[model samples]
Target: MKLPEINTATPYAGLSPDLVLDAVSHCGLWPDGRLLALNSYENRVWQVGLEETAPVIAKFYRPGRWSDAAIEEEHAFALELAAAELPVVAPLVFDGQTLRQHEGFRYALTPRRGGRAPSLESTTQLEWLGRLIARIHSVGSRQPFVHRGRVDRATLMQAPMQAVLASTLLPASLQANYRSAAQRLDDAVAMRLEAIGPVRQLRLHGDCHPGNVLWTDEGPHFVDLDDARMGPAVQDLWMLAGDERALNALLDGYTQMREFDDTERALIPALRAMRQMHYAGWIAARWHDPAFPAAFPFAAESRWWEQHIADLHELADGL
Candidate 1:
C-alpha cells in the first residue's frame, strides 16, 4: 500500500521558549522560569518548575502525528490505569480536560515522577514488572481502544518499510539491498503471524521498553503511553525480556494475574523483527524534524544502512 509522504518541513520550528512558558501559564500554572527539556524526540517534553510545588512534566504533541480523538484515547487509558491504583503517570485533568491546545500545539501536564531505569538484569525486577503488566492487561481487556492503532504488519512493518524507501538517506546503491531485506523480513513476519492464526488483542503500554519504565524503592511505574495501542499481550512483554531466564521470570509473575496464551511466544520473533523495521522507518519519517537528524546522525551514513540491511536479513532468517 502506498503511504503518505513524510512531512519534511520542520514542525516544531515555531515552538519557542516563550511559547512553551506561555502555554504552561495558559494552563493556569505559574512557571518558575525553569524548564528542563526531557530526552524525547517524538514530542517536546519538559520538566517545568512551578512557583511553590514540585515541577510538572509538560508534553507538547508532535504535529499531525495523532488526531485529537486518538490522543484522548491515550489519556483516557492512562487515567483509567492510574485510577486502578497502577503506577501510571496520567495526564492531569485541568478544568475537566486532559487534552488542551495552545497556539496550534496540543499539550498535556502530568505531575513529575522521578526514578532511574529498572534493573532488567535482576530476576526480581522482571517478575515484579510481569505482575504489574498482567494487572494492566486485566484492566485493558475490559474494553477496546476506539481510536488507537493496532500492532500489525501494515502499521509496524509495511508502513515503516515504505518510510525507509521514501527517505533520501537510504543510499541509491543500497536501496535494492534494503528493499530486498525488508521484503524478506515482512514475508517472514506474515508467515509466522499467519501460523499463529488469531490471538487476543487488548490495550497495551505499547512502548514498554526499559527506558519507559522507571524504578524506585517501591516498584516499576510505566510512563509514556505515547505509543499505546491495541495488540497481543506479548507486545507488552517481549521488549522487556532479554533472554530465556528473563522471559521465564516475567511469565512467572504474569501467570499469577492472567492466564497467558502459550502460543503467543511464537509471536515474539516476528514482533522483534517488526520493531527493528519500525525503528528505521521512524527515524526516516521523522528525519525532517531537527532533533532526529541531530540525535540519529548515524542514520545519515551509508554504512549504517548497510548494517541495517544485513540485520534485517539476519532477523528474517531467525524468523
Candidate 2:
C-alpha cells in the first residue's frame, strides 16, 4: 500500500512508498502492513503497521540537507546508543546496516518508540530529565559514538552568526509588508554573538531546543538525535540554566547518574552562552518565516546574553 507522507521538508517532495517499500523488501525489514501517520517533524518519517505486528518508523534522507554518509553516521550512532543500553531511540537495521539508499536518497528504519513530552511546569519530571542528561554525558566517548565529527564550540559559535548576516541582507518583504521584528532581531542576534566564550567541552545534544525532547514513563526521553555532536557537557544545560530552580535541580539530579564537582557546576554560564549563540543563529536563519519571533525563538530575549556577560564581575569563573 501507498505510505503516508512525511512533513516539514523541501527535499523529499517526490518520495513515495514505491522506492521505500521496494528498498525495505530487499533489506527484509519491511513491516507487513499498511501506512499510518506522517511525522510532522521528519520530512521522511512515515509510520508502517503490519498484521498483528509491531509498528516501525521509516525515514528517507532528503537530498541537500544531509549527505548519504551523514545519514549513515546517524543510523550507526543510534545503533551504538541502543547497544550502550541507554533508554534512547534505537534504530532497526537491515542486512546489518542501519542506513540504505532509496529513491535517490538515504533511508533507515527503527522501531516505533513511545513517550510523551514532559510538561515545562513539572519540576519533578523536569528534574528527572536532568538525571537522564547526566547519564548520557557519563558515557565516555567511544569509537563510533562521538556525537559529530567536526561540531566543536568554536565552530558552533560561527554558524549562527553566518546565518544571521545572510538573513539581514536578504531582500525586503513582499507588498511592503515590512517585518520590523525580523530586522530588529537580526540586529539583536548580531550584537549578542560576539560575547560568547568557551565552556567545559564534552558530548552535547547539539540542538537541545525543547521541541526535540519527549516525556517517557522513566522520565524525559530525548528524540531527534539529528544534531548530536561532541562538545561540552554544559552544552545541553545552556537553554536550561535560565530557570534557577530547574538549573539547581538539574545539577542535583545529574549526580544520580554521574559525579560532577563544584568546578563543573560553575561552568553553567559558558555552556549557556554557547547555547544562546546557537539559538540566536537559528532565529537569524529562519527569520524569513513568519513564525520566527523577534525576541529569540526558544530562549529568553537577546538581553540575556548581555545580562550573562555582566554577571561576571571577575575573570572567567571556571577551570
Candidate 3:
C-alpha cells in the first residue's frame, strides 16, 4: 500500500518508530528501542533508552517553522544559561555541533532531566522561581538576537487576529461579531500598552507557563526555550502568578536578584488580551494538522467561538 506525502507542513506525519530510532543512531548513540513520546505540540520529542547507559532526549524541530539562524541562537542561549550553572537543559554537543540533521529532519539531543510540576501554592517555591527567572533575565539583557524574532503586538495580536479571521473555522453567524470584538480588543490593548510607555525588552522564555518549569529537590529547571524571543521582562513573570499576593511574592524574590520595573505591571492586562486572541489564532492556523483538532475539539463548535468572542469583548471592556 502507498502512503500519503506528509511533507514539511506535517513534519511528524512520517516519523515512524523506525525513523526515530534511526535518527538517534545517526547521532552516534546506541538506541535500545524503548521510546517514549514527550508532551510537546510544537515539536516532536522522545526519550530514547541507551544500551547500559542513561536515556537521552531527542527533539525533532518542526520544519519551516524557524530558520537555521534562529534555531542556532536558541541553542547558544541554552548553552549560555547552562554555563552559568543554571538548570536549563542545554542540547548535547556531539562532534562539536548541537544541531544535527538526519533522515531529512533537523534535531538536537539532550540529557533527560526529570522532575514534576512546581507547587505554586507555596510562597517559597514562587520566590525561588522568581530568583531564577531574574537571573535568566539578567543574562538575557546582556545580548540581543539578530536572527530571532521579538514578542510584540504584530506577531502576538495583529497577525494572529488576521490569521484567525482568514480561517474557515469561525461560523459565519459569529464571524462578524468576532471581527468587531477582536478589533475593539486590539484597539484597547494598544491603548493599554501605550499607557505603559516604553518598557525594556529582553530575551525571554516567551512561553514561561507552569508546564515548562520542573521542580526537584535542588530547585526549578526551565525547559523548552523553543518560543524564546525578545520581549519585556514582565512577560516571563506574569504567567506564573495568579493574584496580587502571588505577584508580590514573585517580585520580592525577583528584585532581590535584579531590579524589577514596577511600571511593567500595567501591561499585564494588555498581554492577557493578546494571549487570548493569539491562542485562538494558533488553533485556527494549525487546524489542518491532525493534532490540533484532537487537542482542541472545541474550536469546531460554534458555541465555543461565541464564548470566545464574548470573552474578548469583556476583556476589551476591562482593558
Worst 10 residues of 1 by lDDT: 1-10
lDDT of 3 at 41: 77
Candidate 1 residue lDDT tens string, 1-319 = 3322334388778778788899889989899999899999999999999999889999999878999999999999999999999999999998999998887788999999989998889988998999999999999999999898899999999999999999999999998999999999999999999999999999999999999999988887999999999999999999999998999999999998899999999999999998999999999999988899899999999999999999999999998
The list of candidate 1 runs beyond 4 A from truth reads 1-8
Q: How far in Å is the alpha carbon of 216 misplaced in model 3? A: 0.6
Residue-wise lDDT of candidate 3 within 198-278, one digit each (tens)?
989888988899999999898889999999999899999889998888889899899999999899999899888989999
Decreasing lDDT order of the candidates: 1, 3, 2
Rank by TM-score, descending?
Answer: 1, 3, 2
- Give the residue spans of candidate 2 off by over 4 A: 1-10, 30-33, 37-42, 67-69, 140-157, 164-169, 172-199, 240-242, 261-319
Candidate 3 whole-model C-alpha lDDT, 0 to 1: 0.89
Clash-forming residue pairs, model 2: 116-215, 117-215, 160-281, 201-232, 202-231, 202-232
Decide which is better by TM-score, 1 or 2: 1
Compute the lDDT for candidate 1: 0.92
Q: What's the true lDDT of residue 288 in model 2?
A: 46
Residue-level lDDT for 16 in candidate 3: 84
Q: Please give the CA lDDT of all the candidate structures.
A: 0.92, 0.56, 0.89
| RMSD of candidates 1 onward, in order | 3.5, 7.8, 2.7
RMSD of 3: 2.7
